[model samples]
Target: MDFGVAAEDEAFRVEARGWLGEHVGAVTERRAWERALGAGGWIGLGWGEGGYGNRTASLTQQVVWAEEYARAGAPPRCGHIGEKLLAPTLVAHGTAEQKARFLPPIAAGDELWCQGYSEPGAGSDLAGVRTRAVREGASYRITGQKIWTSLAHEADWCFVLARSEAGTRRHQGLSFLLVPMDQPGRIEVRPIRQMTGTSDFNEVFFDGAYARVEHVVGGEGNGWRVAMSLLGFERGVSTLAQQTGFAQELARVVRTARETGAVRDPVVRDGLVRLWAELRVMRWNALRTLGSTGDAGAPSVAKLLWGGWHQRLGELAVRVRGAAGGVGPVAWSASAPYEMDADQHLFLFSRADTIYGGSDEVQRTIIAERVLGLPLEPKGDMG
Candidate 1:
């Protein structure tokens, strides 16, 4: 339960911080930074043997690297889903050939990946997935739609969950396939414009898209197991890094409050104090939960904690801005419509925090049934 960073980890922190400070820059500059990080052997740091990671690295050292990367103000990592989620899963379940082909490119930052888990009908209830994959001679022809796919337009590949068996329902019959996105005309990506007026998320369509037999991970009909493993990776060491950005946002709100005299309001002052305290609690909880590797309930708890905390922080940010929060540019025109300040963007985008990924309701149910051993919630008859 000791949370202290040891001396060796402190040295590693210095190295990580210095490297990120020198290389980190804007989103447009991320590819070069990613390449630089890859060249430095900082991309994949935990895959055992023959992989590019320092397999000897301890959990504390990993946490140190993540913390320093975020504290240095590095651009939100573009290669995160690949390095953190997919690579580890491949190391655990993928075939030898699959690992050899995909791991190197991902470690080198030459490829990016996205998850195609959510669909129009099967979001939080992933067992309800209707996207079907029909087996052809040597490949599977994938035909379905996926919604709220983050970075779909920018990804080189997607690991999709599609039903491989016709008669199966819920989690049975699903398969995890790694499909390439460069297919002409068969694949389409249309951005979902956020309230921020930017489209980082996308609606992706696969009409007769294909993945070779070799691309299936964890074997066919075992996709639920593999998909759940990947979700566990989603809450890995990267969570510590993400909180650094949250820390920055909180600091901004505090500074604004002091400048705008909002600090004089007792209510505003108390609210800021509570937020600061809760953030510290969150960091400690993350540190504690990191050791419980593969715990199904821990990720959901982490998600619920941060999702609600962030949404509340967004509200605090607007309140501190006082009247100026509503006074931003309003003309919705080709010239300059949808322009929003940092506070405005935070407020609007945070609205979806509880809705995306797994909704708050879904996370609570997971905690209740899985963690507490409670009875399953009854579902309506679809008959």
Candidate 2:
């Protein structure tokens, strides 16, 4: 993989950086920034052809754009799930009609998407999903509960995996359906409050929620394959942008260490150096894997690397704060509850880093059974 950023790519970076620097904070400004990105034809880079602003962005150009966007401290992308995860899957496996209907809205920053994959019993073991979507005439009536659904309360649509054919087990007889979230009385979203006092995670229940027959991508009984493909997209170019955020967090930790005099501790200094070095390794590894063709195990490798790294960074954040790290919010009260500081939030949120988006154990299983060709773990039957 080439590490050098081309001159033209650098030029595009400068252009992107300038735009982001000019307009990227505040709700109104971020909305305008998104529209500007759409108007400037920068939203769908590397998605290929059909000109929803993805006409001819080379891989390097895409990387440069992501790196620049993160460096600018741009507002969290509202259209990311559609633009990154769902759009690419649609382009690859979706019907032409599906593409025409969805891609434009996503590219224009007009709609948002959230994943509807994880369920109560099927978080890491995706194939264990029990959501049922029964076909009736032109629509599928979906019924089941999904937990740990990120942004379910905010998403316009959700690409769901459900068991369409009954009596089939494991990875079989499933379908991928794009279900809308606006169905009154049919879909419910209950927010799951994180330790950071954020309600971003949600429990979503679908009771006869409907997805049109044509909205199913990759055909019937192919949900497993299609779902795995989308998971591959989870580890794509956006990871480079994520690294920039990680860098900022690390910088914060280092600054805290300096300010609190924790840097004087030899052990803390060594930990800081190690964190910096590991982050560099992560960035390089992410860049190296950018051009991959969605190999079955590559996503797991990326997950294993970054998940553990971020978890460690969270630990380092608390550690550098010395004894104060153990303390909660000031003016603690029973009625009001304690709010977490930035580092405290980081430490709390990062505890789940290894557990979500496929847990560390699940990642290890994929690498072992799929990548290393090891035997599958033995299954026990309670019956």
Candidate 3:
């Protein structure tokens, strides 16, 4: 892979860098930050303009934008679920009407979306989704619960995978529906506080919430395919930005080590060097897989590579900090949860890096069964 940026990509990198530097800290509210990004035509850089609010750019240009955004320490995107995941799915599988109706708001960052794929009973086993969406006239009345739903409290919409037909099991009779979140007394979102003292994840309940029939993507009873397609989209350009963030965190850890003279230890120094080298390899791997749409295991492979690497970084972060990283704030009977520093928080929250999104076991299974053409794992009879 070419390491040098092309001239055109260099120009885009400069523009994106300049714009992010000027405006990153201006709109602290993510909703307003999203509007600002939309106004700058920064949202949906890969989609068409018929959405009226989307922008089109080359893949390299999108990569440039992502790297620059991370370098600028830009705010985490609050509109990503809509623009990155949903919009692409809409373009691919949605009806013309669905594209026209949903794409515009997402491009403009006017709508926020959350994924409702996992449930208490169905995390990696998505085919086991039990949320029900029964059709009622021109709409479907959805009734069920979703767990580990990121950005649920802040989202205006949720794309849910639910069982639409009764007496059907596993992947059969499922439907994907885009349901609104403004229904009073019909839907509820309860935030799930994490060990990092953040509530970006939530548990959402849908009690007969209405979703228009036209909102079903790729037709009814075919949600498994669409959901899987969206998962493929997961390994898109933002990975560059994620790597940049990891670099920054690693830099912080190195700085901490140097401050306390830990870097002088040969063992500590060796671990740091290994992490740096592994990250470079990970970056190269990511670049090699860009635009590899036909590879069934690309997304899972990418996830496997980064998940363990990140967890190790977290472990090393706390280790570099020695005992201090292990300490947390006092817990006085009714006091708030512990507020952690950068290293401590990274150490704690990153424990989920291998677990969420898709667990290491799940990714390996995908690589084995899909990529390696191995026999399907045996499932004992449920009856």
List per-prediction Cα lDDT, in the order shown.
0.84, 0.83, 0.86
Off by over 4 Å in 1: 26-28, 54-56, 323-335, 380-383
The all-Cα superposition gives candidate 3 an RMSD in Å to the true structure of 2.2
Which should have the higher TM-score, number 2 or number 3?
A: 3
lDDT string, candidate 1, 264-333, tens digits: 8899989899989989998999988886865769888889999999999888888877634454323245
Best by TM-score: 3
173-264 per-residue lDDT for model 3 (tens digits): 88888999999899999999886778989999999899999889989899888988888777788887899999999999899889877788
For residue 167, give model 1's deviation from the true position in Å. Answer: 1.1
| Ordered list by lDDT, greatest first | 3, 1, 2
- The predicted structure with the larger lDDT, 2 or 3, is 3
118 Cα displacement, candidate 1 (Å): 0.6
Off by over 4 Å in 2: 26-33, 294-296, 323-338, 380-383
Candidate 3: list runs displaced more than 4 Å.
Answer: 48-53, 323-337, 380-383
Error of 3 at 367 (Å): 0.6
Per-residue error for 199 in candidate 1, Å, reads: 0.4
